[model samples]
Target: MLIIPAIDIKEGKCVRLTRGDFNQKKIYLDNPRDMAIIWRKQNAKMLHIVDLDAALTGEMTNFEKIREIVTDLDIPVQVGGGIRSVDAVKRYLDIGVSRVVIGSAAVTDPKLVERLMKIYRPSQIVVGIDAENGIPKIKGWTESSGLKDFDLALRMKSMGIERVIYTDISRDGMMQGFGYESTKRFAERAGMKITASGGVTNAEDMKRLIELQPYGVDSVIIGKALYECNFPCQELWYAFEEGITLDHNFSTARKK
Candidate 1:
């Protein structure tokens, strides 16, 4: 399974919020591009980025900063947040983003997703299903969409969406462990490949997720755990980067 590091950008800085609560946020780095480079240097296979500001406001407030990161990184970077229109999707893909994740718009505007599906390859588009108590939430998890998570997943499946980034809001950023059973159930019912997100505490959680690989849980996006160095492998990477001289093109190597 791929361990994807998450970079949540708010006001052009890298930050992570607890349980999707804007007020309960903590800044990790001042420059998100630097953080992305750090992850790349650490041998991250793929990067996951979210625009917290855009997620809440529906505006690409940090587009320039995100663009900078995309330009500098050699690895595939998938981005999510405030992607409500076809133009927004185009802008990201045009700038070399590997994939664009559709969130609230998947609930509010199914046609937009359909239009995107028609325009882009299925691998280039994904839906983010953020849920609380089994009910899907939208607008940065601030409003209830009046639909169950499974229901929304099924709807998206019917709309030609083959993969989803499933996030259980209650477990997000708490470091209590991810919603393993919930994620497993969602994968089983939806029959779609899942990139599990939120509340992944440590290596043990990763082990648990690996067991679900047979159910189409291919990759996971970890935010707080990665930033805080929860994995022992991160320490090794840090020490190696600090002790040795790394080739400038080392991070550009494409390896799974």
Candidate 2:
């Protein structure tokens, strides 16, 4: 399993929202570029970036800064937030983003997914499906789309989207662990590469995700765990690199 790190940008600063609640956010760093550099030094292979401002406002508010980060760093970046048009998708790709994640766009203007997939390869386009209580959430997780998470995943598959970064809004920033059932189920239905996000408090969460490998979960994203110093990125990376496949403690009691 691949271990990825996330950098959530709010007002151009790197911040992490608790339980996906905007009102409860913690600023981890003022300069996101500095955080990116730190991850790079730790041998990070890929970077996950979310423009919180853009997600809520439907504007590419931090593209300029994000563009600079993408250009300055050697690591590949997958960016998300308010990406609602083919033009916006093209803009990010033109600037060398490895993949563009469409969240609200996937629910509101799904045609964009088909159009983007036809233009760019499936690997270049990633659909971000964030949800709570099995319902999809949009606009930075502040509003509910009233759509089932797996239903959206199946739709993306039909649109020729082969990759997704699934996040559970309820588990996000809680540092309790990932919503493994939802993520694994979505990956199973989509039959595509999935990068799980939200919570992920420790290495055990990662191991749980790895146990679901048969379900098509390719990797996972670690945010609060790493930012708050609860889990070491190197340890997770080494475990995956060394092929240490430990059994996950994914009992029903643990799901809650």
lDDT of 1 by residue, 105-138 (tens): 9999999998998999999999999988888899
Tell me the tens digit of each residue's lDDT in model 2 across 1-256: 8777899899999999897778999998999998999987666788999998999998999998798889889989999999999988889999999999999989988888888877899889999998888888887787888888888888888888888788888898887888878777777777877888888898778778888888788778888888888855565576776543333442233345
Instruction: List where candidate 2 sits over 4 angstroms from the true fold.
Output: 242-256
lDDT of each: 0.88, 0.84
lDDT of 1: 0.88
Clashing pairs in 2: none
Best by lDDT: 1
Clash total of candidate 2: 0
lDDT of 2 at 163: 80
Clash pairs of candidate 1?
none
* TM value for model 1: 0.91
